[model samples]
Target: MAIVGGGPAGATLARLLAKDYKVLVIDKRRLDSDPQKGQFTKCCGGLIAPDAQKMLAKMGLALPQNVLVSPQIFAVRTIDINNKLERFYQRFYFNMDREKFDRWLISLLPDEVDLRCGSQFKHFEQEEDAVRIVLTQNNKTHIEHAKILVGADGAHSLVRKQLGIRGLVPREYISVQAKFTAKEIMPYFTAIFDKEITDYYSWIIPKEQHLLLGTALKPRENVSSKFELLQEKMKRYGIKLNKQVEKEGAFILRPMRVRQLSVGQSPIALIGEAGGWISPSSAEGLSYAFRSASYLAQAIKSDFKNYHKHYLDNITPLRRNIRLKNLKAPFMYNSQMRKWVMLSGLQSMQIDEN
Candidate 1:
């Protein structure tokens, strides 16, 4: 089997399945190298949800010190657009380098797993018994045959398009994240919600050396103008934007229909952002990405015929919760009381409770 991504979802799945099957993982970026690690992933920085942490721990995967770039987060500060309501509390959350996290996961793969770093999946041709996969590395083309091809690539995945899997790919938005050099990177995490952006939220996560600021907005919004507003907003917290270091962003997908999970009997599976597993409201995709990869790995090994069933079963509840949150997003943006309710949820995430 060949997996066409080496992100959290793809790498995790490849690692899991490599024990029972011959797996070849392909990625456009070189995972073994680190000169430009973070630049390749283009993630929203490191904010692993509680469920995600539990899942990883259950898998016997402990995060090493080298992967972490910040102290354990004890609290977070959340605010509305106008700065009228600010809520702060000591909760349980942590931060890491997204690319380093990816690198670490990829590095953990057993040597039996064939890791094609810097190799791009050009396309695949489905034969009767197997699929002929095509890839290009260092301008040289190659082909490999595999019974399954998993698309763990992010939104706008080439695998997703080639398979003719449509529906619900419409609700995609742009998430722009940039790095900045600053004197003080806050210990606590900061999240902001603005009606002006209206669809998704923004965040400020502090690494040991840099400040990571990002926003997910509708394609119609002026991305540059939103960055300006974000800068002004950060000033309220005493975070002055310093020399900009680097920037990375991508389109995140939120599927609109169950048909989006419609993968026919073909030897294919779209699991991560490619499968529209991201949150509709928050744009957080990691938890779902990890979970979906696990489920897809199961389907690939045992119930290949029922792949679509497994896919639907895994994502049905997620989509429902996403819809509920999307419904509540506007209220949280428009009403102070509602924003309090939102903050209250975060406030209630006490360490002991967790």
Candidate 2:
């Protein structure tokens, strides 16, 4: 078996199947060594939400302290710039360094699995009984064959493209984020909604001595200008970003319908964002990644020949959750509805001014 991508989904699946199968994981980023070796660290809020925490508990995993970042979040301050309305909602998130977190997950992989870092998956070819995986590392090409191939690769997944299972693929957006030196830290996360900027959303997450300000923008649009505008708009709420230390961007998937989700056919399967398991409204993918990977692993273990059927059967709840989130999207994304919710203070909490 071979897995492309070493993110949470791939790593989790590798860990689960390592003991059972001869697994090989190909990841472009060198998490085991210098992550900065010409690799793009994913752009994310790096918050481990309650759902993700629960998944960890179910997996019998406990996060080490080194994975955590400072100013632990306990609330989310949602702001609607158009209505000048803002509300606080109780939420808990473990702020952690994403790269380090991925590295830790990879480190947990058993010795049975073959781990290949800094290796890029070029493409794949399916034969009669086995699949051919082509990878490039250090400008050299390598080919390997596997009976089962899993695509835990995230949005913009090449494996998904190769599957050619055509339906409604999830909508794609470019997420741009900048890390600025933090003069101070906020105790909670910030969610910003401004229709003028984007119908998606924006966010501010503090990571120890650095503050991250990011927004989801329509791809190919003036993303740089929009990001700058987002930074300026944040200043209105007294969230002035300090000198920028770094900037990063990545593609995020938004599944508007359950039909958009594809777990892949036999021989080739997908998990995490590649399978459209990410949340439609919040873009929270960690929980979905862990859950989907777990289901796939369970399916493979239960029945290899019928793994696809079992995988689909196991993900019924996940599909339902996506539908529920789709149903809730309007109340969160629609300006009028969101304004009403904010004005009504629905499900919102009042923070002590003192």
Candidate 3:
């Protein structure tokens, strides 16, 4: 089997399938022994709920205890049109260093799994039963054959385009995120939402040395302008910005149909964000990536049809509902709705009740 893209979804799938299948992971970037290489600019503030942690444990990976910056979610602070504060407190959440987490995950994969870093998937050809993949690494061309191809690539997935699958088109949505090492802010995951400023929310994830501050808006909104607004809010909260560590942004694509998960002639599957497993409303994709990779591994090992049914019946409906609700309530970003939904969901999982 061959997997494209070596992010969380690709790495997780490679590790899961390595035990039974000869897995080869191809990526556009080459893996360096240097730790810095794994520290790519991520838009996420790196807040993972306890339920997500439990899911990771089921996959034989445990969340690092010491990596968390804080665990005190004092309140869900929301700003109204009049700039009033609405606070709701249930429980605390953990903040992590995304770079550290990604590096750790990559290291957990077994040696048997062939990891080809800096190798970009140029294209592919489908035979009767297998796929012949073409890749370019260091200006050198290479070829590999596999019975199944898994695309764990990010939003701009080459695999999705190559398969000619019509799902969520590009430019449908956009989100901007930045990581900074600032003076330690409150040891909490605080979200501020307002419509007039930006049709999205801002987050502050306290870390050991600094805080991860980020803001996101839809494609139609001015992201750079939103970032500026986020900076001003940080200042208003007395959150000192020490230095800009990293900055990155990406388009958020919400697939209109769950069937887009299957995007190939056969023996090929798209997992993670590439598969459109992202939550349309919250734009949260990491947990979905982990879950999709696990499910895809199961299908590849047993029955492919079963994989489709399980994903569709168990997860797709909820995602669809969330998307529909988000479409109907675009004003959710106007107030405390986003934070409320997240807190409510976390509370429902007993993550906050405890």
Whole-model lDDT per candidate: 0.75, 0.92, 0.66
Lowest lDDT block of 10, candidate 1: 345-354
Output the worst ten-in-a-row residue range by lDDT, candidate 3.
345-354
State the TM-score for model 1: 0.87
Lowest lDDT sum, 10 consecutive residues, model 2, at 31-40
Say which prediction, candidate 2 or candidate 3, comes out ahead on TM-score. 2
Which is superior by TM-score, 1 or 2?
Answer: 2
Judged by lDDT against the true structure, how good is candidate 1? 0.75
Checking candidate 3 for backbone clashes, the offending pairs are 29-118, 30-117, 30-118
The CA root-mean-square deviation of candidate 2, after full C-alpha superposition on the true structure, stands at 1.2
Question: Between which residue pairs do clashes occur in model 2?
Answer: none
Error of 1 at 180 (Å): 1.9
User: Is 2 or 3 the stronger prediction by lDDT?
Assistant: 2
In model 1, what is the error at residue 151, expressed in angstroms? 0.3
| Ranking of models by lDDT | 2, 1, 3
Residue-wise lDDT of candidate 3 within 200-276, one digit each (tens)?
45666666666667665676667788788778766776668777776677666655444444434466678878877
TM-score of each: 0.87, 0.97, 0.80
Better of 1 and 3 by TM-score: 1
Q: How accurate locally is residue 184 in candidate 2, as Cα lDDT from 0 to 100?
A: 77
Instruction: Residues 127-234, candidate 2: write the lDDT tens digits.
Output: 999999999999999999999999999998999988885456898899998999977777789999998789899999998888899899999789999998889888
